[model samples]
Target chain A: MSDSDSPSAITWCAIIAATCLLLFLFQQILWLVVPFLLALALYYLLAPLNKKLVLSGLSPDFSAALLSGAFLLLSGAALLFIYPIAIAHASEWQIALLRYLEGGTRAIEGMIAMMQDKFVFLRDSDISNDARQNLMNFAEQFSDKHLGKVILTIAAWLPSILLAPIITYFLLKDGAQLRRFIGCTVPNAFFEKTLYLIYALDRTARLYFLGLIKVAAIDAAFLTIGLWLLGVPSALILGIISALLGWIPYIGPLMGLTLSIMVTATDFPGDMVLLYWVMGLFGVLRILDDFVFLPYIVGKSMHLHPLLTLLMFFVGEAIAGVAGLMLVIPILAMVMVLGETLEIILLDTRLRARHTYARNLHKRAVTRDLNIS
Target chain B: MLLNLTGKFQAFKGTETPQLTTMRGITLFSQVATNELRAIKGLLHRRTYIKDEIIFDEGEKGQAIYFIIDGKVLICKQGRPQDGAIAELGAGQCFGEMALIDNSPRMAQVRAAEDCTLDVLFREDFLGLIETHSRIASKLSLELARMMGERLRQTINSYVL
Candidate 1:
């Protein structure tokens, strides 16, 4: 039997169904959804600073406006500075990408040769030469077919992504008013409970997102320092990208490992020793993340089982692809909270009876002065 | 006729509703200025209860204090009959103030003795006030402490006599 506090199977199904539906809808409007999600993250990140400002006697509206304006100015200046430099070096960067791809292909060939040498049956079969040819072809095809599309997609995202700060400013300034509006709309019989639910949902999202930022910061620091010490080129950029990718759970860390391996192989083609060290570094990072950082930082915020998390990852990917992967956990966590709260409210016979009584009371009062007789 | 219409128009435009007027006389808000009271009004929620309706059950976790704006309410111990109500409170009086300090199970149940309207101030909003408007919060806190002390003295006197 399920614990009393735990949601029933029907509630769980509803939660999952709601999550999938929302994910599908989000995938359709990904441009808007992406910026909105970013704004939510920014809101949580800056909320503490806003709270401090409020405590220091600034009105929420003034504090939010100040923070949003400062963020816009800082980001705009950085973009202006970087835009010219990025354009000037665009062709050089493309060539550098191809070189890295070629280096990665060679590293694979080297591994194949070493494996074939160790296994006499493989050496006799000409597997190394065949694999080398296949790797070279695949690398060339990827650069030719996918590179331009990737750049175009990023360009398209830039304008919509700028909406994040504006949305965050509104959220900070009017969040309480929005909450008050919602409370006012609910029937008085359910007012307090509804307010408590809103408070709980806000707290859950805030803690989980803030915890994620802390975990990412820790991962980036560890990887950057490790890669720099090991002489990996562009170590800081690689570390940050990998740390971000790590947000997607099992698949994310694996993708990060693949990226680091490719970069290390490209930068130091002949060094199997360094390649092994890079692999070992990621392996340790994976272990530490699974055991230490996640549990300590994120803790019970998700309150989801590991098996359920893994299953949802596949379901999310199947429904919305990469966007699904990114959106699923947060959506699921929120739906879970909603479903559980609704279940408790629906099952509370006393509360339901009280609501009915109040409704009838209101009806009688309204009719008392009528002249139906 | 022209003057009466203008007076009615002014009443509609004014900030002081009947409930706000009742709130102004509440002992807990005695020292608060009109501007500060308006700010506090934003943090209060209005609820109405029918006669004999249970507002809250004893042992339920308390999250807010309720001040009657009209009509009356009965404060009673759970498992006691209607005739055994411990206190009958009228307009301008408040109950559940202890919840502002802690989230303890309510010490007693409350029911409407007649059709009533109340303004509720939640603990979360109160704490937020403490953060942003400490001066107003301090005055309210002092009144709350004084009220509690007065009640304690009355209880001790009853026992001693």
Candidate 2:
């Protein structure tokens, strides 16, 4: 018989199709919902403080605003306080990088000649025949096409980048009302449970995600400052670049370590000192992040398998590029919350109906006895 | 406006209104109405009856329509079971509307089947409910008449069938 005629198979197929259709329809509302999810996470984390503030005679809204203001002050104060040091570190590293590039070109020429003959290097590498020919062409093309626009684009996007705190502030202030609004939108049959799941997943996402951002920033700072102090030329520049790469998770830190080793090796030939020092620093940090930081930060919020987490990251990267990778975990967390709640609601309804049926049957039996008597 | 909130309601013998809210999003009008109806239910005084208590004997003036909000009240005519049930109802149902509207005497005996609650909407309250929810009242009237008609036919046909 056709599967359509078979009972169980048809129901399964129907359910899957319906779920996909619902996902597509609700895609636009995800953005509005996402910030509130973060708000709820902050709400949970900051709730005890909020409650104490309430006991001290503050309204809920005022406490929310004060806490939000505190968070903003911390972030803004951080940018203000840390930026000058970071910029100095970056400028010093930049100068060191220019010096490295000058000497490194000669070292590259030697490597290219060796690679072209023995390593079967790409054709662009064999600059031996006319090494002087390409320098002007490369510089001219780079300036004309890419350099200025990159600087301009970064400046243009800076203000919007600063808007995250503003968004966080509003989310904190109105987060509970926002949740209730969303809850009200759910059919009453599923409202309370659905809200619970969303709140749970939201807390998990904040724990894992907000913690990772801090970890990445700290890693970048550690490497940059260490490189600067090591008297390693261009140390700060390379440190940040490597740390940013390491933020990619498992495979990334390996790439970062290799890059740091390669760059440092060139600056101080056979200077195993810089290479091993940087490696050990990152290794210890990584251990802290993976063990103490990650567990406490992300904890059991998602309950996703490691393999699934990796898969989601890659799929997210493929679809949305860099922003995709940053966003997918929270989005996945949200979908999980919704799916779990929907299942519970469906199960509850069926159970209730069964209960009512049994009650009706009992009433019928009672009626029969009365008639007999 | 369908039912007055101030007047007392005649009930069975000893039952009272239970304190509960109906679950939400039930598509049935009866379910939604029951929840809204409870807001005015406090003005509705209740009484209960034992299993064999005669709620109303036949030929008595039917001055009110008893709402069986919970438990069953049996409608036993002098002779029949099926014909009697057609005149009675359980939770979320009501009866005695004919006398309620047209000023007639009770056509059948209403006795308590168990300890039961009846929210009796007297002539004034019954008319108030009909005025407020004419649509529900009309739907109810049609269904009630259809049921009584079906029972009359069944009893009339019993001689031959």
Candidate 3:
């Protein structure tokens, strides 16, 4: 009469079905959900600092307040000192980019002609011409159709972005109490497992976010140094963009390389020598990043298989575009942890016994009600 | 038919409620400061079980240590549930303390011999306290070690005699 024997396959199927339904509902409300999720990420990033301050003899409230104040001051400093410089650079970059695009088209045409001349096979082939035309069309379409819409969408999301800090502040201040309230709702047999799952998720998210920041900083430094040594214009800005893009995993590094190559192609124009050198530098740095820095600094925290990660990336992109691509890995990792933990608890004899007991009691009440009616 | 079997078992939820003061009497937490105990108390899960209810089964993974706040609990070896009652614990005594040190399957089953109230300290919460309050962690670990030593001495003495 073991409890584990009583819960049939139907129960497990029901649980999975319910989870999928809930996820579908969540996707429908993603606009509201995204801000809270961002706040939760911010809370995980900052909570440890608050805990350290408290451990050093400060009250939790005071620590949270101090950290929040410092964060606001830092944001203010960036706005005052960095925004003006960035805007000025953006205007220059816009003019430079337009000039580069015009020059780039001529460069591509010349390269195609040279390739066809050098390879007699290509001279007779129409494929080279078709490929060149496709590339030009893609660039033209992206610049004309997509870029403005992307900027407008970002402007639209500005109000929701403001809610993140306020949500994060309350989370940091009352995180434990909120956790306790959630914990209390769990049945006695599952209480410990729930606590363990929460702790594991928190640790995993904290390590992942911290590891990402470290990886980005290292990438930015390496790119900046490499570009500066190569005498590329606006090395700092390009390096920063590359580092930010690096967060997107496999596709991101390729995009960064392409951007660097375009800038190199523009600056050096017909200098294949300098373009090859820049490509070589980016290739070497990418190898170092993937093989050495990412493995050591990130340290397999997500434990996701590379193939599965790629699949998730594609699926996320299809579902919610770029934001989904960025968020899917962490969310999937968390869900995996939660599912495994819940499965263990659900299969536990004690929990099953409790459930069986409750179900029997419910049956008795239902039968009694039917008898009375 | 499962319902019939469960219906035959008498059920009375234990009335005892665990308080911070009760933690002072439990040997594992005795040396912890009052303020620290209050914090620890918040982490404990208080639960009441009916008589004949299975608290936990043998061979199941343990995640928490339980202190008996009221009534009695019977600990039995696997495969001899009816004949073997290895130990019976009452109020102030704790069982499953080894779970706090490491995650392992329970060596024995624990069932409520009578309606019982228990205060459970989960391993993760205990580790969390150890991170935040090492002093309290050290005190509890020392007490746990002392208790193990006493149990070992008693077992050896019984064998020698």
Candidate 4:
């Protein structure tokens, strides 16, 4: 965003191309990428605390170790406390979940019936019957066909998730050393600009992730308050789950709404009014998120045009499916930072000339002593 | 083996690299204590330049102040051949100090008179110190202000005469 190095049209194209390529590559090694991304977000979340410790006279190594240790202990303690409660309610949750699924199926059937009543064409056609049959089949086969697959996927992800803390620890500790290593590779003429580029890239990523966390927190609070007011049971948990699910852009909000509808239907059975209210609440939240929360928070941090953002989501989905949809914006933000800085460095005639001059000077200096000998 | 390793560790800990020694001698860092200097050292980057290599050009955006560790450098103006070199600076001296305060374009070009080593402190790192290590930053800032004031006085004197 620096005026001195405004990105050119070619640079913009390159950034988009690189982002798509990286997204495709990321999908190929998604297990590693997912954990690495989680670690990056965790690192940014814990960085300010680690920085405070360092400023208080603790060595970076010591601060990183201390922070990581405390995080592990806290996680372990929370797990220990929650595991027993979860185990006790396991059967209850399973039955509730099954009931909710059935409720969701029924809600869909009701909506179709209502539509058919409103439109004689729908009632006459096979669309309503076909949809009803599909819903019934899905509900019946969900536990038998898909539950094991879901469980297996989670089990596979466990070890990769465990890598997050280790990656975060190193990032906290040796971040400066890594930066210095990168700096060492550049020639003297480009060193300062390269250093600034590194700083800009780091700032962009941190701002984006922090903005996302802020948006998520705001969404959760509003949802929790709304659900509580509506007399929904376990409103806090449901709100939190819905807000987390809302991270996946277009598909995520829809999924969250479906979840809320399922819970609302099951909790207040035969109450079409509650279902309608829940749908209305989600519709309002979606409006607020799109127009208010997203524009001011995540959108501001990225500095990307709304049209480009929408296009990228589709391009990302086409290229790498869901992973691309989730990763595109962050990837584009990073690529923009890199592309802009690189364009400045490459396009500057003086800087490139200075580098060439420095090389020539070095060559002369070496030969000056050699010729005398 | 433990005793020998401990002895080696003590030896290593007691020694200061030449760059750090040179940094201590510079007027900008003169008020900084050894411990504070060590803290600031983490923010410094050292690079070597061959003789006659242009360090930075006139009118270029400045981002860092460089302290000379070895050899000398010439500060000159571009397209002012008659004026010749304005100043030749040697070891323990620093140039581009004004960059630490603002990102204004450089007023003069600087080139190495001889092969040299320098430790660079970037403006962002110095600003970071202002937030986290105020005392050290204030001391360095005071020294910088005093140096700039002296330079301003000389320029005034030259004009008055």
Q: TM-scores of the models, in the given order? A: 0.85, 0.48, 0.75, 0.88
The residue-by-residue lDDT of candidate 1 on A1-373, one tens digit each, is 0257578899999999999999999899999988888888899888768765654445557679989889988889999999999899988987887787788777878888888878888878767778778877867876678887898898899889989999999988887678778878877556776676666677678778888888899999999999999999889998999999988766888888777778888889889889888888899988898899888888876778899998998999999998898889988988887787788778978778878887887788789999866
Error of 1 at B143 (Å): 6.6
**TM-score-based ranking, best first?**
4, 1, 3, 2
Question: DockQ for each candidate?
Answer: 0.14, 0.01, 0.09, 0.33
Model 3 scores a C-alpha lDDT of 0.73
- Candidate 3, residues A29-87, lDDT tens digits: the string is 76666777777667767876776565544455656777777776675677679768867
Most accurate candidate by DockQ = 4
Candidate 4 chain B, run of 10 with poorest lDDT: B5-14
Per-residue lDDT, model 2, residue A214, is 59
The whole-model lDDT of each prediction reads 0.82, 0.56, 0.73, 0.82
Per-chain TM-score of chain B, candidate 1? 0.86
Shift of residue A282 alpha carbon in model 2, Å: 3.8
Candidate 1 residue runs with Cα over 4 Å from true position: A1-3, A120-131, B1-53, B67-72, B78-81, B88-94, B97-104, B113-150
Model 1 Cα lDDT, one tens digit per residue, B1-161: 97975574444434465655777978899897655675677678778888877788788778889988889999998746366688899988899998899878889988888999888888877886886688889999999999999989998999999
Query: Which DockQ-derived CAPRI band holds candidate 1?
Result: incorrect
Candidate 3, superposed: residue stretches over 4 Å from native = A1-30, A80-90, A99-118, A124-148, A193-200, A233-236, A285-305, A341-350, A357-373, B1-52, B67-74, B78-83, B86-93, B112-119, B125-136
lDDT of 4 by residue, B49-136 (tens): 8877888889988888999988998899963423768888898888999899887989898888888988888887888788778888
Residue lDDT tens for model 4, A1-373: 4565768889999999999999989999989888888888888889878866655555667679888778767767886897799779867976777788988888877777888899888888887678778877877787779766886897698778777788889999887678777878889888888888777678778777777788889889989999889987778887888888888989998888898889888778777788888888889889998899977886576778789999999999999888788899888988888898788889988899999988887777668768653
Candidate 1 collision pairs:
none
**Quality of candidate 3's docking, in CAPRI categories?**
incorrect
Q: Write the per-residue lDDT of candidate 3 for residues B1-161, one digit (tens) a residue.
A: 86753343212111122476788788888887655665566567777776666777787778889999999999998646589888888998899988898778898988888878898887877887788778778888899899889988988998999
